[model samples]
Target: MLDAAVFQGLSWNLLDDFRQLFTYPFMVNALEAGTIVAVMAGVTGWFMVLRRQAFAGHTLSVIAFPGAAAAGWAGVPLALGYFGFCGAGALVLAAIAGTRRSLGAESAAIGSLQALALALGFVFVSLSHSILTGLDSLLFGTFLGITRSQVLVLLVVAVATVAVTAFAARPLFFASVDSDVARASGVPVRLLGLGFLLVLGLSVAETSQITGALLVFALLVTPAATAHRLTPRPWLGLTLAVALALAVTWAGLALAYFSIYPVGFYVTSLSFGVYVLVRIVTR
Candidate 1:
């Protein structure tokens, strides 16, 4: 919901430039939503990387494209399309896992789904006239038109995601680390995997609303990947991922507010920069 036309310049005074970030109610809502998104994406993304499901996460993001396009074509709420398609995509991926997780199966399933989704997205885009005006936001995301209600919706979803993640943390980690051992220990690995994909789907959908479909994956994966490179310990990685995500989201929002750039580029660049820095330091 960023206004592509607005160009708010930053003043030389550091304090004034920072203060102007909160001048509009929309900025406040964007910050709140970004904060919520950073937390949920960071936590879930940590597990997602550990479980080697980045491909699945990418596929889900691809699905969001058509989901939004179809919503536009139908004159319906984009949120509904996003959540509905993403949740269903998660289900399909989970179903392919069957009674156990198979890396091969997941890859093939994600590949097919991604291909189909891209095709459908193009078809929908061609059919939907209304979507073109907001195509940039749909693809890259914006922080311009966030309302109080949307922020409230993000809050509710974020709370649920955090609560479920907390409740399932132990078993989920065990399963993600070693599904065979966790299953032998009666951890219900398949169920946990299903639940995780669902949570991930929701996270993708929620983030896509603010960060755009394509860029949300970076928010979900980059910070976690950076944290993983920084620490081998699970808790530290989790904490670091959340911290990094929050930092990049806030920085990206502020920079985009003051310059002529898409918020997605700023976020992606910041996250990648941190990731590269970690890679260098660790080497």
Candidate 2:
């Protein structure tokens, strides 16, 4: 998969691209919004990769879709509805399993919720007056339509997510790497797990707005997975993950603007490609 010719042609210079980026208001908005989402996803996704909670992240995204659709049908803000629903689902999972269940059981619950959410989203779409295009957009995403207000909202979420993650980093890491040891050492493993789930829920809900629920996994998994493969150092892994996420989001946005496909498609494809490359190299 390593293409020497393509690698050779890729330019790192930003000056030429800088003007192109600022020439359009949509591009600016996309960049700002994408960067904010990337930072949050990157930080939380690092723990997600380490803890093997990728399935939970995916389930949260799937559940958010129906919530967004229902919100749209009711003429409310989609983000709030999406977060509320996914957060509730996260809470339910935490309560039922006590955040200490085996991976097999967790996976089973996530799978069930994923299916249920998609079914509900489809049913809502069928009953609503809105066309399939709107629902489809929420599923696959369309960054070109993002407004400046949305960008501002993204910034706020990003800041809050990053701040919380920073403060919770030590205990979160301890619990994720070894919950038994953490709990033995007097760490509130259950509480930590629930808090992380809440953060994951919010991140997935916000990202679903930009990349859609189906494609949110790309942002939530790829960069962190790649970073984990490249290094075992926690801080280094997080740094690499954030950098990779930012690069993919910015590059993907540029490619989408220049291509015919939607931004989510390009972003997901790019992220998957990077993960594949990292896997190959690490192997």
Candidate 3:
């Protein structure tokens, strides 16, 4: 009888805590944006890990720094700069990788590009005195001040990204798994590669709004990496990745609400913890 009473009390407390998360307007907007970002990151990051393009994804993330910084300096929407520059950076990375086709050469080219991007980002920060004002938010993210309009933008981008990814899933999967064989078997290998990179760019830009530029790997890589460690099948891995991302996002937001820490720190810590736990369990 005592155990049953204790269990009931615990369950009610948990329910109340959950309800508290949605009690605020800003919290609702944050969750909505976080959900969209998590889904997009999970799907795109799964393929990114499969294709061994984590480097390319990281490069796009680095480019996001300058993109957001430039936008703040120019008084334009941060999303516009994020998508514009990341899309352009993806083009450059794709063009370079296409030309070289060697691991060493490609790594060197990407490293060079990353360096230049960081340098330019600093320049923008210096140019826009106000850029540093919210620099922490650009690097580490915040759940506060999320507007309804931002949530709407995230929904639109998420739908478009998911749709394009679904349309190209079959061929993209084939090419990702075995490009040479897929190409010989009539897959549009090159076009699919470019299309996937573009989609990745879009997802990265959208994710940056939530997790910030430097910490994008928290959502984009960790959950996908954890799911891959947990499963080999594509559908199962994709579902698990999305689930893990959403879990971390909600938990992070909740924990941040009760503390003085930044949401990104909680998110990244939760994501890394789950990834490590999965690695240990799988091993």
Best by TM-score: 1
Candidate 3, superposed: residue stretches over 4 Å from native: 1-14
In candidate 2, the residue pairs with backbone N, CA or C atoms under 3 Å apart (3 or more residues apart, or in different chains) clash, namely none
Better of 1 and 3 by TM-score: 1
Estimate, for each residue in 98-217, the C-alpha lDDT of model 2 and write its tens digit. Answer: 855787886787788789999999887877887434877889887765688888887887788789889989999999888889999999988888888888888898888888889997
Any runs in candidate 2 off by more than 4 Å, and if so which? 1-18, 99-102, 131-133
lDDT of 1 by residue, 154-203 (tens): 89988998899989999999999987899999998888989999999999
Using TM-score as the yardstick, the better of models 2 and 3 is 3
Tens-digit per-residue lDDT, 29-121, candidate 3: 988899989999999999999898999999999999899999999999888889998999989988987895789989989999999999998
* Pairs that clash in candidate 3: none
**lDDT against the true structure, each candidate:** 0.88, 0.82, 0.88
lDDT (Cα, 0-100) at 264 in candidate 2:
87
Whole-model lDDT, model 3? 0.88
Q: After superposition, how far is residue 46 of candidate 3 from its true place, in Å?
A: 0.3
